[model samples]
Target: MAAPATATILSDEEKAVFAELRNEHEKHRSVMIKMDRYYEGVQRLEHIGLAVPPELRRFETVVNLPRIAVDEVERRLDVKSLMLPDDQIANEDLRVGWEYNDLDAQAPQAHKEAMIFGRSFVTVGSNEEDPDQPLMTVESPRHMSVKIDNRRRQMTAALRQYIDPERKTDSATLYLPNTTIWLTRDNGSRWNVTDRDDHNIGRVPVVMFLNRQRTGSWFGTSEMHDVLPLTDAIARSLTNLQIAAETHSVPQKYVLGMTKGDFVDKNGDPIPVWESYFSGIWAHANKDAKVGQFSPSDLKNFHDTVNHYMALAAAITGLPVRYMGQQTVNPAAEGAIRADEARLVKNTERKQVSFGASWGWSMSLRERFRTGEFPRNGRIRLEWYDAGTPTMAQRSDSIQKLSGGTPILSREGAWDELGWSEARKARERQYFLAQESDPYFQRIQEKEELNDPSILRDPVQEPDHA
Candidate 1:
């Protein structure tokens, strides 16, 4: 067969299509470059930790916490259940300090009514430092009432939920809440009313935990009664565990096993250790040790406790123990970011458009979009007056002004036309510019859309079908 004839000619449309494709490829390459740069910047900020200056430190830390915890906490709490109830009552009348109030005022009336119903409010407590040590006494409200029986009941219920059924420990037998707070009002003028204060405020248990071990285990320790020390010790131990988990180089399972049980070698053999030499990993402040009294005692104990755990895990796992860097933002970038941020903000003499609205407007030609509501046409709309449609003026003005009176350029519609330009090309560029100029603003729009674009649509009424 004769060799295929050489291709002769291409249509104008085909040429345009090829050119468009080329342009798209170039756009994609440019985007990838920018994204790579952005990712590198983020990685540098993350891995370098607080190497960034003061202002950015908080930004970095706040973002990192939840991202790191997401995989960890997902199983612990069903996130949906943690949401506060819709009708949850907030005691708005309560203030941190005493405020002079008129008897006729709504808040005073509410407070009086609550008092009549035996509802107590939280009061600002005094913080008095212990003269000799780095300790402070924090006093709770003197007028508050607590129900000990009710609290114990709730604690028992919670215990039952998590406890093993076969090995049920009697919650009461395990040393349940025993601590109580007795409160009395100090209304000097109303002696009779004040006299009944103690009666109105019932004693409530201060909850605490106990550490229990198996019967044969040499590690079984007696149940201590102090609530504060127990809490402190537990908190310290948890902190130590957190530090170890953070520093460990091996898999999470290995680190967890090291903490909960005994550390094992690579061969799955438990390291035999004598019980006598292994002291408890935590210590509490001794009341007898004053600040001036120096034997390098309690502080040393605390420091040693933290350091010992950290060092042990680090040595075992071969992970470096790194100190937290100073919290500070980059001085050089602060001024520039701030300036760009301010420019990104729009200052109006009249009503101010929010960043969200500005972003949506920037992304589309929908000038009639207000905020919330949906129309029957099935587009996420922002406006109520025009029902998400662009005004005629908007369409005309946009086409003329944006197209710059160029005869060769194609004009889709006047700017006011609702959803006039749904073309992917224009929107991509618009959103891309938005992302480059303000990552935060871009993130908000992306998040809103992700959650539900129609969420902002106004609720509509339906005609009765019957």
Candidate 2:
């Protein structure tokens, strides 16, 4: 636990490496920004300002399907705890670090960001104030990037940048396996090394979580990518529906052979045509002028079009129709609801598999930071809550059947399957062992054993035995 060596200067080679990694990070900025806009429901509004007329732009609406699509999948993924094969409960050392970092709240944020932007990062470092609890943080892709060695399948370097608006400067941290460099620059100044730390941990402390990554790809695919276009379409449809309601919800009227002067107000100024039409009063001195009305536009087409795109989005993203705001007259039965969510549940499980590995790696890094040694013996695993939506009765029945009078599943394993936290399971275990050791309970058990017919018959003398 000696403090890492710190310096205020970087070598020429290190400077070049930092520059390259920063440039690589810059390459993903635009894509992440666009994804952010979509996730925040602002991407379509940007287009509306250009496509919609100034007066009608206010009526433009956003359906926010991207957020819904991402959230539907994100809500199903919940990492409960970390465990090793031989442990009855979660790893206490890792749990300390996890709670120290408030990961119960932050982990979901990281997961959602990974889903939105294809990847997110976790950085692990030693906490100088408390050696036993390491510092862990979840980083958004918007500000971080990593360089991976394809052959080794490891991150060789990582860069995290931040803009200090209050100071009117920008700063970045470049992470290497053995060194960490901090650089800063003013609005127009060159990059200067503020400080550098040589920790020599032997591996990059950044853990990258990829969402739905394909083979041979360095970056994962964003969950919002497929739904973005459909989301835009839905927004446009809703905006148009809003515009139609504003302009044509009421019957539009036409006047033949009428002069502009006929629509003048009491102030002798010409009243706007729209104002006169909506005012519901038409007066003219010309007797020959004629008036006729056109029927209001049918808005059902817009609703149908929006619903069509929503259905397509639901189908493409494996989201249920109800999640897309489509409702049925009859409430679906529990079985039907579960069936509709099968694909989504499966997809969530896949994400859990992917993110779970990164989390385990991060916690392992935390252990290294704390104990100065890597976890090498048992397999480290992250325990995730069941992604499927099963009723309590159903879950209980299933667990009972699996653990009842059989060695197929251990008692601890049954508790794990029941979604009990490590703390709760530990408490229950204590109570169970206490009950087994109780004198009254032991006496009752002995009495029951003595009165059993099998025990009474076992004492019978054997006829032919020696």
Best candidate, lDDT:
2
lDDT (Cα, tens digit) per residue for candidate 2, span 1-466: 3343354556777777787887998888888888898889877466534377677768867878788878988888887888764665678767767888999899999999999999999998766688788888999999998888899988998999998666667888888998777678845657777766667899898999899898878789889889887877777788878888978987878889887777877777888867888762367667888878899988999989998998999999998888887876433566676788899999999899898888888887888887788778643688888888866675566666888845565788768767888778879989989999999999999999988877645345646566
What lDDT tens digits, residue by residue, belong to model 1 across residues 376-409? Answer: 3332212211211123554456677777866533
Distance from true location, Cα of 330 in model 2, Å? 7.1
lDDT scores of the candidates, listed in order: 0.26, 0.81
TM-score of each: 0.15, 0.83
Q: Which ten contiguous residues of candidate 2 have the minimum total lDDT? A: 1-10
Candidate 1: minimum summed lDDT over ten consecutive residues — where?
Answer: 190-199
The model with the greatest TM-score is 2
Candidate 1 residue runs with Cα over 4 Å from true position = 1-91, 94-196, 201-309, 313-320, 324-466
